[model samples]
Target: MACLIKGVYIAEIDRQENRREDKQIAPTWWEAFHFKCIKVLEDDVDSSIFGAVFEYMGHQIESPKYVIAIRGTMIKSRTAIRDVYMDAKIALNELSHSSRCELALEAVEGIIGSTHHTNVWLAGHSLGASIALQTGRDMAKRGYYLETYLFNPPFLRLPLEKIKCRKIKDGIRFMQSFVKAGVSLVRKKTEEYDPFILLNSWIP
Candidate 1:
């Protein structure tokens, strides 16, 4: 799972960098696994958040999987700054809801509406992780089961006292349990390069 998350993160970076260059770079490990970018989700209303949907062709499974990967803060524009503010507001429970997260969820729903898939997975790093978690819960409410893989998530100490919504609190609790289980699954010590350390280095 850690390896998969790292591949997704690298792929996202590649996709962003490639957008600026004239010639596209070669595909990364995630793309090598037959994960092709199907849509890039960005709009005027939700300018703060950016995400991409990739269609993965399963080698063994009969059905395909859809993976939605979101990009974290880059400090490249006003929208990026707004998204960073949203992350802080969400952590402190200053806002009633997160618009950026909702936008990402809407993008996922749009993609899912167009195709049939076996399962949907969400992944992101830093601020993107928060959006992914919030989006996952929203999808859950809409009768969609989504598996999420978050890398180096911020706002670990979100103030529960500031949160007024009981449903939102419940969603946070569910996310905590889900993350804890994922951590347990990948707790084994390894002599190889640690993805956690790599993720930390990437974060500022």
Candidate 2:
């Protein structure tokens, strides 16, 4: 099966200064992720484009395992979530804790509900990657056969490498001036930007 690329936008509310507004990110915003997968049971990296990033980076999805890919919007993790947080501060909005979970859960449902039961591996660039890990855990708890690969997810330290990508509630954060600057500099339509497309380098 060839990898599938579907674009979607999710709504979010910032939780800092009291807000009830809806923000919309372009479907193309997700058209900007890139990733390569390492086969879990094999010694080789598949080199298949599993999701939107591959397309963003100018590649095509061509393999059985890469068949189900869904691109979601605006839920940036440390990489993109910071912008969500700061933007909320600017707009004076808030997300009740439950609402946050709803956002993630709904996304998980949307992604998984559209796929087959074959060996599942969840991978996302940033916040999307974090969600992928969360989905993996949920699927395991529900007895679904799945393996998850996260790319540049929020840095989480673990005694073991395999447990590094586990939960979203436990996601760790690091202050980054460079990320903030990039978000600020690229938000302007006049600035000529390609949605946040950072490399996959960071696992602990």
Candidate 3:
């Protein structure tokens, strides 16, 4: 799902670079995944698309109903200015107050409220990951826990991995093992049966 989201980002870049809508790759790529591009989200600053919402069309049991994918900072693109500004806001711990965060949060909420028994997923990378993380946290606080996937998310505090102290690293690792075990047990008890098999009707 992360890969698919990234593909949409790449296609958007391609679309902007060539200044042609037909050159976009998202449609073909999404078709392969049995998903349809339902919305292309634009940033308030430049009106350049920075996120996408895909609606699943496949008949796979338990597949997500919608996916909200956000693209990270692009150093050289139409959205570079907005992206860099958002990055700086993140560094300064002002992401929650930013419009980007609000936009993502609204998109996810819309999907959740649009229908009953909906399965929505969220994914983002780098700057986008920060937005996704914030959105997820906000949703959880509101009693809505959506499945979220983050790639290369920024850490506000000093990363533990970069610390030179072995004791701190070892202690963190030990605690992580315990946390993982507890999470595994919880998943086993609450998980629904999902075979992940796709229906033949949707195949090309």
Best by TM-score: 3
* Runs of candidate 3 exceeding 4 Å displacement: 159-204
Best by lDDT: 3
Instruction: Please report, as a residue range, the 10-residue window in candidate 1 with the lowest summed lDDT.
Output: 195-204
Clashing pairs in 2: 14-93, 14-94, 15-94, 19-93, 33-53, 34-53, 76-80, 76-81, 77-81, 77-127
For all the candidates, what are their Cα RMSDs to the real structure? 13.4, 19.6, 8.8
Candidate that beats the other on TM-score, 2 or 3, i.e. the better one: 3
Q: Write the per-residue lDDT of candidate 3 for residues 1-204, one digit (tens) a residue.
A: 776667667766776777467766666767788998888777888877778888999999888888888888887757778788999898899999998888888888788878652488888888888887788777665556667788898776547879899999889889888998987777677555211111111110
lDDT of 1 by residue, 118-180 (tens): 367788777777777677766655556566788777765768889999999999999999998
Cα lDDT tens digits for candidate 2, 1-204: 112223321212122222343333323333344433211111012211123322223354432233223222344332244435523432342222223223444444554575653423445444445445454554544545454555555543434445555563244323344666667776654333232221112121
Q: Candidate 1: where is the Cα deviation over 4 Å?
A: 1-22, 26-29, 43-49, 62-64, 77-80, 94-96, 114-118, 156-204
TM-score of 1: 0.58
